[model samples]
Target: MKPRSLVSQSPTSLKLTTGCEALDACLRGGFPCNSLTEIVAESGCGKTQLCLQLSLRAQLPISNGGLNGSSLYLHSELPFPFRRLHQLSKSFHLSNPNIYADHNDNPCDHVFVQNVHSVDHLLDVMPKIDSFVKSSRTRLPLKLIVLDSVAALFRSEFENTPGDLRKRSSLFFKVSGKLKRLADRFGLVVVITNQVTDFVESSDGLSGLRIGNLRGLYSSGRRVVPALGLAWANCVNSRVFISRSGDGICEERREDDESGSSSVGRRDRRRFDIVFSPYLPASSCEFVITREGICGVG
Candidate 1:
């Protein structure tokens, strides 16, 4: 073989469009294939909304910035939002009429969902996905694998003791390893959502290792950080954060008012930030959740 330096450049990894222009731009294209991306956020900040949009976006043709494939969503808690998904499907179809013009199938029908109740259940499910993708019966190639929330299974499964912590970290590696293998084998884009906990400032240096933008882990004027600590942080290739902030303004405020304020209303102003990523710098953009879907604001 020729020396390593003389080898040809590798092909660029595939990216799945987020369907939001500003957010997509901030992501420097979109969520990348062959890597694990973590979406960290507090409750009610549109984490699931963004994931729902991606499920539909993945079905678009490759020319339209999609993978032209299907998505598998492994949700850890709560019922799958079938009704909301149907609503977004309508919006997605309207947004891309030409893409679906030749086909009559519902895009929402293509998203496969499974609830993972515990750590064991998730571990059991991961190995089987490889076979599912390779099965000839699958009509569409799988491009996206989303774990709606990774923190739920571990929240109560392990205690804070040293032995349990080691076990928890070991399990983390197992799941991430399998996901990475699948990503590399199939050029898949894996997106995992994580819950956030209130950050408690400690003089000890251990707390300083928490990840976020350079300004620290404050969201919505309150300090918060992704759950599962640093052990889980090392498992992913990228981390994106979603947050909300506002005063008493109406939640449905359409645009920035005459007061020259960017915020909508109470809990209306939402922001998306790149906490850390191998391919993207720490950047941020604003976004809104409308009846249609999540759209990035200027």
Candidate 2:
């Protein structure tokens, strides 16, 4: 019998670059492919915007620390923000038509966007997503798969009734398991956005009542929240919390004072906190959304 070559048994790893030099350096590359990443935050926290930027960045060539593949943006609550995507693309100076163009010569040919409002619709579209990955021949890899706000589908579909708590939790476990398998088979970075729910004390005092806060309210009482609870956090490899800080005015004044000067001035800052990670930095960094690209705001 012939001996197996060492190369045949070795496992290869895919590491994506985040497009932010500092962040990429800290991550030792970017998000790992074939893994699930969670980004959680409240409304107006710039989670969606960061996801959009990452989606665009994932299509660059490998020399530039990208997979040069297509991105699938699955928006559960809203339409695709095409204008924001275009603006970011222009700012990054990502002018490679081969990376963005389709067979028919469209600029955004590689970017696929879908809005899924219902859990049933999401399930129905599973096969299509798989087909896209398989048909791409893995040469033009499917770099990223994003589910913007997974909590929406669960909250709307499950309702988190007292009687259905066990059933709903079981269903979420199954769904999350399938998502993990999908990421492994396709060699893509799977990103899921989640909304937080308040943990309240229960009448029995043994366990607490969990309330979904999609609109940022905890008034309507529910026995359990529909967000898959702790299981959701455990299923993903990393989690990022994005939030806004400081008014834009402070930076405006600094910019005005530093006009015609080359010194770096105060700028409106957005925070990207690495809240959870298995192998990355845990510190928060300030950044600014610019007409060109996302830059560190010192």
Which predicted model would earn the best lDDT?
A: 1
Expressed as tens digits, the lDDT of each residue in 1-298 for candidate 1 is 7564423645556799898899989988899989999999998889999999898899888888998899999998688888989999997888788765666667876799999999899989988998889983645699999998899888879999999999999999998999999998888999999998888777886666646565567677787878998999999999998887734345435445545565445466578889889889888888888888888776
Q: Model 2, which residues run further than 4 Å from truth?
A: 1-12, 92-107, 137-139, 197-228, 246-268
- Candidate 2 global Cα RMSD: 6.4
Q: Write the per-residue lDDT of candidate 2 for residues 1-298, one digit (tens) a residue.
A: 9974757633545667766776566566777787888877666556687777778777787788877777889998776778888777665544555654454343355568898887678877777888877877644567788899888888766655775766666666666677778887877888888875555566875334322212222212222222456556566778765555444556666677768663433334556666567776656666666665566665
| Clash count (model 2, backbone only) | 1
Clashes per candidate, residues 3 or more apart or on different chains:
1, 1
Give the TM-score of each candidate.
0.90, 0.76
Q: Give the CA lDDT, 0 to 100, for residue 181 in model 2.
A: 82
Candidate 1: which stretches are off by over 4 Å? 1-11, 98-103, 210-212, 246-263
Give the TM-score comparing model 1 with the true structure, all chains together. Answer: 0.90
